[model samples]
Target: MGGVSETHQMAPRPRRRRRPYRLAAALLVLLGLAGYYLVQNESTGGDGAPHCTVVAGGDAGGSYSMNLEQARYAATIAAVGTARKMPERAVTIAMATAMQESALRNLDHGDRDSLGLFQQRPSQGWGTPAQIMDPVYSAGIFYDRLKEDVPDYADLPLTVAAQKVQRSGFPDAYAKHEPDAALLAAAFTGRAPGALSCSGPLPQDTGDATRVKAELVKVFGSALAPKAGPPASRVAAQQAPADDSEVTLSVSGKDYQGPADQRRGWELANWTVAHAAELGVQRVSYGSKAWIAGKNKGRWIDKAPGKSGDGDPRNAGPDDVRIFVAPLNR
Candidate 1:
């Protein structure tokens, strides 16, 4: 009877399971807040924003601001156009098309299957998805098609020429972007020397001559080389001049010539300007104009005649594009 009097053990209480759910909800809220902060910072010129300036025709043409990504894409489009010998109008059309199609953002998806900067559709024979996704490749293809389909695309209205290539539902939309596109093209194509500049935190690994040369080759083709000095000899020297922070890119006459050579030189010069932040470029000088990254906040400054290179007297020729890479830690 005593043994049978043992009380039955009460069942253990169930543990509360709400803490994990609450923690997860809190985490989601934090993440959402972080995302909101990033968006706000981008829109409000925060440290994370890629501050960029595009001046249409040097100082007199005025300037506009675009995000770093847009500047890079615009530079690429201009490079492609220049390489193809396409006129400024061609670059304008291409840029405007990209602006309308993707707002200058290279997207992985688009209306139905469009892709890349121009949103060329794989289903429509633009190229494979992979090819279309490459900014350089897509740009080349766009220029090629424009040249083929509209031989006189340079003379046609921006919207009409772009529509010929794009065939978009809202063909008229491209016109609105023409003015901005022209500004971008002018800057990137080098018509406006020292007109394009970008400011931001430099990359951890910045100002490598090898890397700069490689990028030049990648964008402008392997045929790219210095126009005057021995390419390897000068680059291999790697000795900073009196400035203590300059790299001279003397383009070869064989590579650039004729009236177009001036534009080509500027194209390279402007490309350096666009990539200043990433490459630690402090100054880009071509012909009589120079863009100083720190001086006047990266505006193009006129160099007094015979002021370049300690009275070397030979005017800064059309083929010369001098890039002064910022010293490390500056």
Candidate 2:
């Protein structure tokens, strides 16, 4: 028998050996791209929208930040608490709840038909989707429930108090946001002057006295009259600014009294601060303290003893909260 020719065919070498190198290179490219975007976002605030900072007690007590929309909602929440005469603690609880519920963004949707900043459920008697979507109305409802259901909420632990009003599946999640909420409350409630500020280019809208009055009515449910003017004068003042480059709104002390009055003043002042970007507010003065947008790096600075209201050399009295609005670009 001829030598049996048995040839063994070798299996083709697998191509798997090169795949790891290619994958590693691709991962490096992805990582580089991610890092580049992160840096860019940090530097320019991503989309160029204005940014707000809530500092706790003059930058020593830590801080938290959110975009313009979140800041606006937070201000509304605080304003509602003030309007309801709820204590700062109540505002803190509401803010913390909103922070956990929707990250302070008024949502048009939520878990199982829940909606708005508080994630209140329409199916559970919260409100119609339209009403719940209104920040002012929603905030009012939250305060009403908090007051009606948890009367002693101010004295209770934040989580416990919030859980009572929310009845959330993750009841304990609220606790994690207390620190941030407290900081925001301090600024929004006017417990901490100059505690909040917004930076970057102002919004495109140039706010005027009329817009200021309108916004005040929208949030506090009443028009804010000038301290020195009659109703007719107030109306005339709201018509248009003499300079057209600037406008001012004054809060009168006649309507408020005692410590609660002071709280309300701060609330209005802080509300102005919160809306500074949107309203084109250049400066806000209450008592002797003033917060100038983009001044001293957007911190509250002391106004001279006799200088307030656009450097008029007259005191902005304790009973008055004066807001000066200027062109955003200016």
Candidate 3:
């Protein structure tokens, strides 16, 4: 006992165990890397916008795949174009309808002669087979009514507002499509409309901005120009068509269209013009009311109409827009 006390055993210097700091740090780094990879590959199954192909038979009376393909393209164009034209809310609703009506696929066949992306019935005054087949026109027509009926559509329920325009037999059908449409809208609008596309096969073909714009001109008219720098040549609209007009546009899709039909006509016209460069449009006409006669005669004007609301005489009807275009110089 006395010896032990004297020895005062240096208390087994508690086997000083080294801290595992480096190991811990390494593990944390590995976890962080794994998380990042998981998120990035979340949507694409590790292959973004994969080139998956499906057989969609024909525009109508074709394979289910073919029918769906049409709708997908229609949805893509509408979502992207509307995002460019109106607000996100409108795009959301439009996408929702396409999702339900055709699974975001343009089906030439629908209940009792209905056709096109919206399943619009030619017999009911939508348009002809060819016209309805044109996605841009169909979308434009849908937008016309949408802007008219949807007072504050951006905030309205997607299904509710869409039903107002579509008057579908089954109003509730649109509800089920909200999820998928949201996804497509997000991807097309560049807002992450959805975390991913449908689990099914991805469309092998998707049009580009240039292609879409060209189709826009084909379906609508040569009333739009691409968003390019100054035009290589421009012909004074006044000097051309007697009915030719002018319109001042803004980023908000606000503009002056003059009279009743004039407003609608011009709105569409201006939209075409705005999309001219993108659509490879060569010439266009904005109603005379839109022309300042002096101020930046050819330059775009945004302050004239639709700025103050219904009071502005130049403002077009909620559904009216009559505008057209020609080659820049011709």
Instruction: Give the residue spans of candidate 3 off by over 4 A.
Output: 1-75, 193-213, 216-330
Query: Can you tell me which runs of candidate 1 are displaced by over 4 Å?
Result: 1-49, 57-62, 202-205, 226-247, 252-261, 287-289, 292-295, 302-318, 326-330
lDDT of model number 3: 0.47
Per-residue alpha-carbon lDDT of candidate 1 for residues 1-330, written as tens digits (9 for 90 to 100): 555433775667999999999999999999999997776454323534556787665355567787767778889889988767778888889998998999988999999999999999999999999999999999999999999999988778889999999989998999989888888888788677556666553444336666676677677764564435544212221364543455555554554556556767777777877777667665667788776554444455677777863222234555677766645344
**Model 2: CA > 4 A from native:** 1-49, 58-60, 203-205, 223-240, 243-262, 308-315, 328-330
Span of 10 residues, lowest total lDDT, candidate 2: 230-239
Sum up the clashes in candidate 2: 0
TM-scores of the candidates are 0.71, 0.73, 0.43
* Total backbone collisions for each predicted model: 6, 0, 39
Highest TM-score: which candidate?
Answer: 2
What does candidate 1 score in Cα RMSD to the true structure? 8.4
For each candidate, the alpha-carbon lDDT, in order, equals: 0.73, 0.74, 0.47
Q: Report how far residue 110 has shifted in candidate 1, in Å.
A: 1.3
Candidate with maximal lDDT? 2
True-structure RMSD for candidate 2: 7.3
CA shift at 66, candidate 2, in angstroms? Answer: 2.1
Residue pairs with backbone atoms closer than 3 Å in model 1 (clashes): 226-251, 226-252, 227-250, 227-251, 227-252, 228-251
